[model samples]
Target: MAEEKDAAEALVTDLQKKITDAFDVFDHESNKTVDVREIGTIIRSLGCCPTEGELHEMLAEMEEEEPTGYIRFDKFLPTMTKVLLERRYRPISDDIILRAFEVLDENKKGYLTRDELVKYMTEEGEPFTQEEMEEMISAAVDPDKNIVPYKDYAAMMVIDD
Candidate 1:
């Protein structure tokens, strides 16, 4: 237990340093924070192509904690940690995928219907086009059930393939 706790703390420190360095590159104003517009580029630099709505969502989430329109390095730590983790660990586990599905499954439904996915993806930040949503659903949804199960969603994101 001690070893595990130590490792976790070390990992958090490493992530914090990495995030600070990444944000520092864009902190030209020396204010230790980046404007909302620069967030997309910073995230992209870290290798995540977040959609416009996703960026907005991230900002809104950050705002909830700090109530500031700008993104301070400390406040953006969680977003940076997620991006770093996703990059370092590709082909996330089924459990992680299921958790993500749960976020979109507002009604606590075990499976995601086409309309539910469409609404979740379109109603929020950047609206996904019909074609894009269909493609995403078709790729993951089971043909027989016409719904996306946790397993199928995990399969769609398998990095090994």
Candidate 2:
């Protein structure tokens, strides 16, 4: 138990060190801080590819206490750690998702209409609950196309190793 705790602490320390190193590359002046705007780059340097909205949300959380113009190592480390760990949770791969979607696309159109997706999502297999269907549709559907472009949707969900 102690060993596990030690290992977790060690990993956190390692992450902190990496975060500091990445921040330093942009810090330039040895202030142990960087402009709040640089937070996205610093997090990406540590290999967390957060979406722009996600970055904005994180920045909002940081400013919850009060607006800040710069981020210190201490503040950045925890946020970066959380982002890294979250990124570690792998998304469903494109190939697997493509195969699954292919099964849904009997007409070979490379897409699924909203109605088809709704039917399959709500009535087929284990089925997605109403909320799940809504969320999936919001993420997977193309507003203009009014269809789930399965290939593009699958690609969007794939995360590089």
RMSD of each: 8.9, 9.0
> Where does model 2 exceed 4 Å of error?
64-66, 86-161
TM-scores, in order shown? Answer: 0.47, 0.52
Clashes of 1: 1
Candidate 1: tens digits of C-alpha lDDT, residues 80-158: 7876766632345667877888887778877888667777788876677787787888787788987777555775664
Alpha-carbon shift of residue 31 in model 1 (angstroms): 1.4
Error of 2 at 51 (Å): 1.1
So what's the TM-score on candidate 1? Answer: 0.47
Say which candidate scores most in TM-score: 2
What tens digits encode model 2's per-residue C-alpha lDDT throughout 55-146? 77877766537666887776777877877656642346689999999998999999999999999977876666687689899998899989
Report the Cα lDDT for candidate 1.
Answer: 0.73
Residue 56, model 1: Cα distance from true site in angstroms: 1.3
